[model samples]
Target: MSFVAIDFETASGYHPCSVGIVTVENGQIVDEFVTLIQPPNNSYNPHTIQVHGIHPRDTQYAKDFGEVFPEIQKRLQNQIVVAHNENFDRNVLIKSMALHGLHYEDLNIPNRWECTLKIYRSKGFKPAKLSDCCRVMNIALNHHEALSDARACAYLYLLR
Candidate 1:
């Protein structure tokens, strides 16, 4: 089966500032994409930067979420989207889209998406934190970076 693993690092609240996608086909990674996004109002919180290390300057000239939504939609629409934490990433996508005047219902996204953290927990793993799961499973992880986190989630899903 083929699927896409996704992750987003937000600038503040639920505003996605960066996105990462890893496409897997027949158990092999087929493609990957990552980009910094200029969020609505170009706003960001200091704490958010501490988590993901993305600064406003980094996305100053980057495309806004509206401009990047088409590419994101193309990758995720009608596909199984896997993320470490579906709630956060999914909400980020929804909120960011709304901020750009796009409606989540209009995106044609799958109603059910996969969460690696949930999968790990279901397998009796107590610590489902992405880095912890990666360590236990011997998967390399770069923690907070969106693309690295997405690739790690893909690897964990592949192992499962």
Candidate 2:
């Protein structure tokens, strides 16, 4: 079965923010998508050169969640979506998407999910953080961008 692993890098902190996705097919990453979304209409912290490494000004040309989610939905349709903390990633991202008036219920795909964090824990692994697992698994994930993180999650999903 094919799957898409996803990760989100918020502006500063995590929660209620933008996100990205990495889709894997045939043991390869077929597509990568990123968006500069307007946060929960609340506030956007700092990700400048850090997690997302995106400055607020950089998002000037990028589309908000409302504009870009259609593409995200197209790719995710009927695909397995795996994440480190699958529920959290998917939930937060779903909520983040909602900021633009979109919801998972609006999608045709109905994503099937798996949480690598839970998987590792059930296997007696000590840590479930993507970076930590990548360290142990020898997968290289760049600091904190969405694509890199998603690829890392895909690698961990492979372990199972």
Candidate 3:
């Protein structure tokens, strides 16, 4: 019943432009952390921008991954992590950390985070995308915004 639910919105190629973390303890949400990140070279892919609506200018003044690593590490280290799509979010964390010369192993978290998508799918939820699952469960969602997505994912995990 205790875990951190995470969501990442990428600028390009697994480079996180924004991250959201919601910490739950004793089945209650205790903390919510969210920040926009300036991706490498402040670059963004047009297609990704279309999905997340985060333009280059939005994060131009934000901290890069290395600058934000301490905050992320403190929240995630040795914690059970959950995500809507575990693979994508985990890969984003891994690749982003690698880009900043940080090691993912240092977090001491699990190799595979809890996945709401898989859980819902196995429970017979059709079209188990975050938005679809949210709709079925009446969980409010703002789609690709990282914090909203994380919050929704957290609620879905709680319900599951």
RMSD of each: 1.2, 2.9, 0.7
Which residue runs of candidate 3 sit more than 4 Å off their true CA positions? none
lDDT of 3 by residue, 1-160 (tens): 8999999999988999999999999989999999999998999989999999999999999999999989889999999999999999999999888988899999999999999999999999999999999999999999999999999999999999
lDDT of 2 by residue, 116-151 (tens): 888888887786677778888889978577777787
Comparison by TM-score, 2 against 3, better one: 3
Clashes within 3 Å, all models in order: 0, 0, 0
Pairwise lDDT winner, candidates 1 and 2:
1
Work out the TM-score per prediction: 0.95, 0.81, 0.98
Question: In model 3, which residue pairs have backbone atoms overlapping below 3 Å?
Answer: none
Best by TM-score: 3
Task: Please state the error at residue 43 of candidate 3 in Å.
Answer: 0.9
TM match of model 3 to true structure? 0.98
lDDT of each: 0.90, 0.70, 0.94
Total backbone clashes of candidate 3, pairs 3 or more residues apart or in separate chains: 0
If ranked by lDDT, best first, what sequence of candidates would result? 3, 1, 2
Deviation in angstroms for 37 in model 2?
3.1
1 against 3, candidate with superior lDDT = 3
